[model samples]
Target: MATRFLIEGRVQGVGYRNWLQEEARRRGLRGTVRNLSDGRVEAVIIGSYEETDAMLAACRKGPPLAKVSGIGLDPIDDPDVSGFIVLRDY
Candidate 1:
């Protein structure tokens, strides 16, 4: 399964993407995380239901520096991706 997360609030300059990458990798999830031009962080997580849910939970808290006011989740019908990656800013 694949889900896209748009994380907002103090996420842009707080190493949110890198931190999310580590979290995803630690959970054995495969996909990408990037910073959006609008100051939010975006992550595409592809994994089992449990893994995806776990990632979403972590995103709610985010890194220590991130305020994480809101997290927007969208179900995606995309092909599965391999490995977790830190993508260029979107």
Candidate 2:
């Protein structure tokens, strides 16, 4: 199973995406992180349930510069990500 998340609040321009990419890679997760024009960071991480949960916990705190307000999580039917990458703004 894959886990997708939409992280809201003080996410963009704060290295949140970059940090998420690194963290996901470190956890050996296949996923992508991107910045939304609505000032949210969206990510899809695919890994074991435990690893995905850990990633979500980390997203809740984010990087030092990030002020994460909320994290919305959902199970994805198909998250066909190859590897962790930082995607262009959507």
lDDT of 2 by residue, 6-62 (tens): 999899888899899999999899988888888888899888888988988999999
Listed per model in order, the count of residue pairs whose N, CA or C atoms clash below 3 Å is 0, 0
Which candidate leads the pack in lDDT?
Answer: 1
Q: Model 1, range 1-90, lDDT digits (tens) per residue?
A: 899999889998888888999999988889998888999888999998999998889899988988999989999986567799988886
TM-score, every prediction: 0.93, 0.94
Backbone clash pairs for candidate 2 read: none
Q: Tell me model 2's lDDT, rounded to 2 decimals.
A: 0.88
Note the Cα lDDT for every prediction shown.
0.89, 0.88
| Decoy 1 TM-score against native | 0.93
Give residue 74's lDDT in candidate 2 (0 to 100): 85
